[model samples]
Target: MNAPTATLHLLPEVNQREVPAALIEALKARFGDQCSTAQAVREQHGRDESSFEVPPPAAVVFAESTTDVADAVRLASQYDTPVIPFGAGSSLEGHLLAVQGGISLDVSRMNQVLSINADDLTVTVQPGITRKQLNEEIKATGLFFPIDPGADASIGGMTATRASGTNAVRYGTMRENVLALEVVTASGDVIRTGTRAKKSSAGYDLTRLMVGSEGTLGVITEITVRLYPLPEAVSAAICSFPSIEAAVRTTIQTIQLGVPIARVELIDHNTVRMVNAYAKLGLREEPLLLMEFHGSPTSVKEQAETVQEIASEFGGNAFEWASTPEERTRLWTARHNAYFAAVQSRPGCKAISTDTCVPISRLADCLLDSVAETDASGIPYFLVGHVGDGNFHFGYLINPEDPKERETAEALNQKLVMRALKLEGTCTGEHGVGLHKMGFLVDETGAGAVDMMRTIKRALDPKNILNPGKIFAL
Candidate 1:
């Protein structure tokens, strides 16, 4: 496959103009200079980090408050134009692509830390607040947000995607972290769900429902998320194994024995080589596990020792520990950049990242099968993942224009999804199905179940005005 020379996603027919003269005049009347149809500006909010490329929205509206969002939504609803919420533009699955092309509701201007209740151990923030900015603000409050997506992605985007990271095993995913949200419905009605309380037998559990809705349901304006006290002691370690099987086996044993893992990331040998070649890191080209322990000093030490013992049982070696703040940050930073390094490693090849989650009991088998399937396909790809949580990523390098490579990658990904579903798992663990994995999701969850989801989507967004052509087009 030849790499695409450029991506050309034109605007939908009804929205060829970035912003109609009437809409622009109305926007100026409502909030002067806050709305613009400037091509250069709209291009900024047009797409996310995913592979799907589209033309810039008709206009980019810099929303400064929830009321502003409501007003924009109401106006757009009147015009019956597609409205796509824009956050940090870091979505790996193209969650923010404006395919129908109405207006990009850029939320960065709405960034505000609403409240930080230390007693409640929760923080309320506007959608524009990035994960890193929120954590920095809460650093002095003795509490910090634990949902780290590594991209400084907006809190709203994180919640919408139900993103998880290296620390998911200990802190949980966005599903568990987001306690409540103030959402703008498609009809421009503002509503709130859940509470700051730790426990609730609340009706419907709408907070959880919207956590991974991917903006097809509603636009999140404000978010309330559970926070944790900064760990008393933080320790990160790197464990090396001679083979991928050994590393996976050690991870399986550690989990089976109930080790409280903060992070148990797997970097296959090929990925390690890629990182070294692309990022210039002095890492051994062997399958390695990047592990972290977070707790009291004694608890951290105990967890480390027990995990190391399990690793040794599976031929683990060079158990290097990084405890200092600098060391831990450096290790995780390098690990987070592993995706970019992998992409850079192969020149002229675009990355096709696939994710799957399996039950812990079947993790080893699933991972082993993945290696075999990749080899059988004869396509070289990089594999790394947050294995502690049974979620892994297969980043396949493919020529964007080559049909054969695309077919091979798709086949391997579909085969992997089938195996995962057979083991009673999900097709996507964190990354949402923006334009990809639509069929895999149906196969995993059954067509009837998918139909029910569509029914709900229609009920909430009858016009399909909210991010059309996303999450299975209506």
Candidate 2:
């Protein structure tokens, strides 16, 4: 594939709005001990995993229930103050930052599994519940939540970003899994969208609109999500490839052949070395595909055999299988730790993570070119991917003190995003457009579409008091 030239553009800055003293006093009085203006807490609630520099919020409100969230929003709305919703703060983009100062409404304390309709394969949960906690709560019922974004991110945060991870290739993303939602609008009024029924042709798809809105539109208080039955028989395997091209080719073919692969992850040679050193796993350091299949005993065996054959066609070797549950957990746990491993590879350095995704047919072109570009940039980096869905991330580690290194990483990121857009893909497949990708959003959606989005934003949030300065500029 021919790589396109990327021209970087400076994102427009939004002026910081001051929080009135009266509002802060009212919040302190209402929430009592729950309201916090302490510097440490504000700093903790201000930023996420991203490198964007922004001041923390003026205060934080630890909400314990939907009513708490509503009351907080109502107070913020009354003051026309921006309310930034905080979850686990695992967002790679700067979604949680209170760039325009207001109050950070934290929902981490509202974690509760409200109800489970096992018969309908659906569960209603508070916004603060983590994905792992929910699965553990319902695992005995033979149901599981499969969207794992590496971090044990809260379901609300995952839904806000419309996250998808390794299992997304098979189970789909939050966009498909979330059945309904109870959201607090900018006006601080609670509204429920969608229902338990499978399909609906009723009005607008408000649930989907809110899922990836990144808190600009509203705050999600509760979610009703579809769950999957635990597979009876499962098997995990890792196959090493002679080259990145071969591994990507194998992934494309597997997807094309319509194989029911539960998860297929690509780890570059550099990433493999880092994982081996960090996670203490003894595996060949080459371009590798860690995969899993789910089905009955006979079907699982058949799927594994078929995948092995496909991998073999592309110079894949050492097909290590992890059949037992403990073994599988170890393998996946190591895989999930790729980010931390990459970070530790270069101590005292930070990573500028890239989330470019292209069409499956263009996976080889997109990934190979990306790898070559990163290699030539002279910045230390590691590559990992959910190749089954044509989405991947590159953790470009750089010393924060070095301007030249940070510049190189940012330039490379721009080129990668442009290449994905050229290949008919997106700047972000799972990670939503926080402050990091505001300019890219305009590029991907065009000016008119962005205008429509702005119109909607103004319609819903007349005062622009929601999570301001995110997704797009007013």
Identify the candidate with maximal TM-score. Answer: 2
Off by over 4 Å in 2: 1-6, 9-14
**Per-prediction TM-score, please?**
0.93, 0.97
- Deviation of model 1 at 1, angstroms: 32
By summed lDDT, the worst window of 10 consecutive residues in model 2 runs over 3-12
What TM-score, to 2 decimals, does candidate 2 have?
0.97
lDDT (Cα, tens digit) per residue for candidate 2, span 10-82: 3326578999999999999999999999999999998788877788999999999888999999999999999
1-474, model 1: which lDDT tens digit per residue?
Answer: 112212321112222424466876787688779988888988888866555557778788889999999999888877777788888888877677777778888898778899989999999999998988898888998888877666788999889889988778789999988999999999999999999988799689999989999898999999999999988998999989988888888888888888887888999888888878776677778999999898999999999999888889888998888999898876776678878887787777767778899987788888898889897887878998888888998988887677678778877877787788888887789988776666565667666777899999999999788887776756
Cα lDDT for residue 307, candidate 1: 88
- Cα error, residue 444 of model 1, in Å, equals 1.7
Give each model's clash number.
4, 0
Residue 373 shift from truth in candidate 1, angstroms = 2.0
